[model samples]
Target: MPYVNIRITREGATSEQKARLIQGATQLLVEVLGKNPQTTVVVIDEVDTDNWGIGGESVTVRRKRGQ
Candidate 1:
């Protein structure tokens, strides 16, 4: 069994993009981990840009700062 957790910023991506991401992730796990698609569990979490940060700066602010 393979468990995948995906965290993404819910800003510009559409529903179709999200679906494709999930499908691709599942496929990768099936191929690389040798997990069965029927038994694999994938979880996608949509996080706000304001709440997600990197290097002590929020993603929204980082984009504005260009760093």
Candidate 2:
């Protein structure tokens, strides 16, 4: 089985968008790694802005600073 994990900031991605992500990930694995779509697992984790960090600052703070 092939497993794919995707993380994004919790910014209210629509359900359709999430579904597309899962489908795209599965298709990519099937095309590149020859994995079976039926057995592939794609997981999306959404971290809160306050809990996610980049460039030594939390996403919440970064957005506040407009960086």
Say which candidate scores most in TM-score: 2
How many residue pairs clash (N, CA or C atoms closer than 3 angstroms) in each of the candidate models, in the order given? 0, 0
What is the per-residue lDDT of model 2 for residues 33-66, given as tens digits with 9 covering 90 to 100?
Answer: 8998999999999999999998888999999988
Q: Give the poorly placed runs of model 1, Cα more than 4 Å off.
A: none
CA lDDT of every candidate: 0.85, 0.95
Alpha-carbon RMSD, each predicted model: 1.4, 0.7
Give all TM-scores, in the order shown.
0.83, 0.95
- Deviation in angstroms for 11 in model 2? 0.3
